[model samples]
Target: MNFSTELIFALATILLIPIYYYFTKLRRIEKFFENFPNPPTVPILGNARDFRSGPAFFKSIHEYTRKYGNMVHIKIGPIGHVLLASDYKFLEFLLSHNKLLTKSINLKFLEPWIGTGLVTANGGPKWKTHRRLITPAFHFKILEQFVDIFESAGNILIQKLSKESGEKSVDIYPYVTRCTLDVICETAMGTKVDVQNSETSLYFHSVKEMCRIFLARTTSILKRYDSIFRFTKDYEIQKKSVEVLHGYTKSVINSKRKELEETRKEGNYSDVDDLGRKKKKVFLDLILEATVDGQSLSDEEIREEVDTFMFGGHDTTATATSFILYCLGQNKDVQDKVLEEQEQIFGGEKCPKVTYTNLQEMKYLENVIKEGLRLYSPVPLFGRRIDQDVEYDGKIIPNGVGVIVFSHGIHMNPEYYPNPEKFDPSRFDNVEGKQPFAFIPFSAGPRNCIGQKYAMLEIKCLLSKIVRNFELSPAFPRHEMILAPETVLKSLNGVKIGIKSR
Candidate 1:
């Protein structure tokens, strides 16, 4: 062959490889979804167009579920096939079982910010080890100790809002976010970022920017490709955000280590309380003391886990608490009931702080929180990569495809939650009879949120304090509130409410 012909043939062969693979993969996906009910997919792009508006995509999925039933498969582009399962039984099986333990590929977007921490780590021995080592940090006893921190933070929030009390209206999300940030930083890293007051702190800005970038990446089709995304401004912002975040975490870790060393050198390795039990350690301290396979976690590993908790612990809880406040603002009846419940606990006491015992007696308030989470889940969707082929309702879901467990859909399912749109906390009165996976605000099964109990305690503490100090009125009517899905469910226009001192 001529030299030019030879070169042309080599290039043709190289191009044909991907083309052939693409067709074969497309055919396989078609065959796989042939038996399943799926929304109409266009050639090559599949359902990519459906997600052009990233935040609106969840609403689209909800509409699709309503039209097409619960277990609907979707394809995004040539390679991606997603199964969005909102069926209660399907979720119970998927989340509770060990076979499908790995997180979905979509979580890869968070690795740049959180790394392979518990939130994004894949299933296997490494994840198992991490889970075991970190679980102790959230033990009931440890969480009980955190109540003081929650109270302190809640007090700060109340004091901050006191200035705005009886003002026309305020967007409460930023205040709640700052308060949660303070609580999580103090609890997780044993350091205080004081983000509630220091609004422009590098740590606070880094976390906010990181979450914004993470959500933006998850919603953008073009941004999913690292080669293209890295050159963009979002990617650069993400990198800088990570730098600030890691720098902060590293400093906290070093400071704690130094403190530990000083204690050890002074022959005061442990301290005991009056009850004779060793003093509880913070999350970072426990992780530092942990040994996986007989070796301690490296600084990067510890930082990843700390960052994961900081992100998970604060953001989701803040979103949930904000929405809970919004729900109360809109539903005066519900708000009245919650305040009545709080009054019953405090009994006209002046400036009563939320004790651990106080949190337990607030059953009515707890139910309200649950109902609010049901309507607006903090983490709306749980995505998993199916590790093995699984059969559900006698249909086979092929292995290697992604499964998105839509918590919002499940929460809104009329069958599970009657009058789903109404803010009725009574549904939780007999929650024991509900389906196992029906109310998964913190998710379900083995990978369920470890900090869930802590989150609940924190929310109750803050909400109790807020309701006691202010009469919350909706800035906009119930129907006017618009929600957008980001790292967590957020108000597109901010959660605005008018607070009058009680």
Candidate 2:
């Protein structure tokens, strides 16, 4: 009996020993930050134990900023974090001097889906080559052509709203997302999206799944059992959906190629869009002409660039525009002010007919858009990987750690604006020489969003059309949905709002 008991005890000890060793291996990274500005951490998991939301995360960071200064450090589950820009000195130092310090490496998962497109993949020849090639495609001339796309989409949308007139407040989320997707499809690929078709909605489903997978991969607890969970069922499905998206795009390229080939045989292939120019019509057309400092995009590279455009172009704008309209609903005075601005610009009776000239003339409407961006910047935290090791505020932040810049934190900092919480566009008016890098809704530096001009034009055009068709106000409690999440932006809740056509 004694012999048998001893053998069983030995087996138990053997199993427990490996478990202890495995845990230690997992936590090997925690001890190096003994002197840094570490936030209160719990054992075994560190700060993950206490990371709550509903303003708690932002408020905790604000406390850390007060206690440890703006350049403090914290561990987000074995990952080191720098601060959101709370002061000009450190902000300039991190952004300007330490260009190498800021990058987007932890966004590793997105590379497969987004494929080293501007937002996801970082440094090396890949980004530089793609950026150089794709940059000019968004030049002002190309951007201007998209205005009609936005206008026509807006007109169609207002027609739908006119149908919804006098009904109880309706949720605008689906409508807004559909409209943005329609516009992006037209502008980026020149396809007439049959949005009523289920196949067309597959892109949105894949995008939503990818966002979920990103959240899963980033959290530390989920990272454990990584070997077993590496290929999640949902992840596999998402990957398959991406394959579908690629196949669809390949078909587009093949069709275009077939046309060119046939034209070559019979001899007439270079006529342009209806404007009498001698280039092909949409983003794909321009990209075919782009050269990366004299290197043209490869066929596969063109596919990747188009995928990037679809990923970047659609969802974020839909969320932002929906929330902006939601905010307009929530604040009567602000809405009235915007209405007055629209009246001055478009003449009150004809707000739906906003020409490019009138869009430029709507200054106060511009400020309203600016304030909405400030209040709810589409992407809350954009991750960048270090290009090289660099110094910042007397510390050596070694290269390869993720640089997670919280745009939301920077946007809401009270120090930069006198009253950051208040929605005031006049802050922009009075602050001329404030700073070039302060308000980065689309981010800054050479790698900022390529579609800022196109995005602004679309948003302004759509909002002008919306204001004409609907006097928006919340059906739910006013403040209930000032912030809700639909991937990158804080989409509004209830989405429930009244509509009245002019």
User: In terms of lDDT, which candidate is strongest?
Assistant: 1
TM-score of each: 0.93, 0.84
Total colliding residue pairs, candidate 2: 5
Off by over 4 Å in 2: 1-36, 52-69, 78-85, 97-102, 196-200, 223-226, 260-280, 349-353, 477-479, 482-486, 491-494
lDDT of candidate 2 over 388-494, digit per residue (tens): 55666665555544455666666777777668778776676655557756677887666678888888888888887788667887764334554433247553344
Best by TM-score: 1
Q: Model 2: how far is 68 from its true place, Å?
A: 5.1
TM-score of 1: 0.93
Candidate 1 clashes: the total is: 0
lDDT by residue (145-246, candidate 1, tens digit) is 788888888888988998988757888989999999999998998787888888578988898898887877787778989998999998888888898988
